[model samples]
Target: MTAARTPLYEEHVRLGAQMTNFGGWVMPLQYSTIREEHHAVREAVGLFDLSHMGELRIGDETLVQRVLSRDVTRLRPGRIQYAVLCNDAGGIIDDVLVYAMPDRGYLLVVNAGNQDGDFDWIRKHAQAADAARNVGREWALIGVQGPRAVDLVQRLTPSDLASVKYYAFVDGTVADVSCVISRTGYTGEDGFELFCGNADAVRLWRALLEEGRSDGIRPAGLGARDTLRLEAGMRLYGNDMDAQTNPLEAGLDWTLNLEKDFIGRDAIMTSRQRGLARQLVGFKMLDRSIPRHGYRIVSDGEGVGTVTSGNVSFTLGYNIGMAYVPPAMSEPGTRLGVDIRGAAAPAEVVPLPFYKRPHPK
Candidate 1:
């Protein structure tokens, strides 16, 4: 089977990006080095080819103060809301951003791997009831992140994004490209995500590259993306949590609004009340060894957990990871161990979000 190619695949190769397969698509793993690419995003502006993500336009009779699938009704139009799309069992389908457009329609930015599954899920749930329509095929998504991202994109965009509050979006044109720009990102920096169509892909990328040359806007790859999200304590789908784990155990309770009834509400409510048995927690390697996905977690001469996401932090100068451990081992300051092949490295369970963004939220 051949992997798919995004519109920006060739552009990544042209810029000397180290390519790799992600969700059956050839994507840039890194442009120069992972450390340099990660640092560039934290210190300055960085561009990323996020074209592989799936986008949907949802229209309806109008959502209530909050939507059933996600906590979006709490969000106002022309703003961005981070939410999790859940299965009927209360398991996560995908974590995505919802843009309540000023134009009355809504835009949903979903992960590439979860596109078809999520689209089917949304359609199934929304169609079950009248007045809701799923509009996914009409949009393509892109992300521009880093500290100086605002100043760089400001030149091409007509609307003053600075006036747009955090987690808010503005309806406007960038370089005259008809689209929606949102003040949101996954890299834990001040960034914007642009939503457009196939017709505007080339123009959007070219305009940003030309206008952002004065700033440090380089095309970043998925490798840097992993490190950056990790430092920010953001979780990834199919790794950090899945159908077996519920939001309460995943530390995403704040996203779930029990006040309104939705799918899987009863199951989650039960778990929350009964208390979480197993949970996802973050830790740093007390020793030099690095933890990887599926790595065994050990403590007190017993196997009690497994690591979900792991990497050597080029930015933090240490190894960090998130793991699923017994509820007893999840508390901060608890000592633990991780199996790095034949060696069991010393580690300690610590608080989440190992790295903090210096920017004011």
Candidate 2:
């Protein structure tokens, strides 16, 4: 299959970004270096082209509530809610963000790789209650994230950026292009995601770079996005959990509304009643070695679980990772060892969100 390219593909290349295949899309891996881009977002500001993600517009709130794990009825217009799409067995199909558009419809943003499967699952269940349109191809999604993101973005748009609270949004023109400016991000920082027409992507990207030039904003890529999100303890859809992972065991119970009727609710409820054998937990390496996916985690000299998402945290300058282990061994401060190559490297269970953004004064 031919790999797809975003509207900003040429722009990335022009900036001398290293390109790579990601979720079947050719995207920028980095413009300069991964570590440099990582710190740019952590300390100052960074821009990202996220046009590869999928978007579905559904008109029916009832069908939306019935399809997604979160209660769509609870979301007021102009707000956004993070949710999961589950299969009949209660395994996650894809984690998504449901945006309650200012009017009656809702927009679902899903992972790039799960776009087709998610659309099919949603449409099959939606029937005639809603119209599901794959609007991803027509859109360009840009993320401006960091400590100074808001100040940088506020300079170009007439909309009141300060009034837009976290997980909420407003429709406005950004750099003269109509857009949905959303105060939502994956990096656990104050940021905005601009959704605009594909034709306007390059102009918007250039405008942002120019406006933020004095503020030290640089184009960041997937490599930095991963490290930043990992530090923030945000789960990557495929890396952290997949169709085989349930919300309860993946440390995402907060995103589930069990009282509401939805697909796979019964299966999840049943799993709750039976109890989970293992649950996801965070850990920091005591040794210098970084953990990788599928690395064995041992406790009491026996294999216990496997690492799912692991990385060398750029902010903390240490190896951090998340994995599933017996519920008893999931507590913070529990000593564990990870098999790094042939060595049993020491590690210990730590709290989720290895990094936290400072509160605004």
Top candidate on TM-score is 2
The global Cα lDDT (0 to 1) of model 1 is 0.79
Residue-by-residue lDDT tens digits, candidate 1, 53-130? 777667751442223445566677777777776666778777777777666767777777777776766666564454
RMSD of each: 2.3, 1.1
Stretches of model 1 off by over 4 angstroms after superposition: 61-69, 128-138
lDDT for predicted candidate 2 compared with the true structure: 0.92
Candidate 2 wrongly placed segments (more than 4 Å): none
| TM-score of candidate 1 against the unseen true structure | 0.93
Local lDDT at 166 for model 1: 75
What's the lDDT for all of these models?
0.79, 0.92
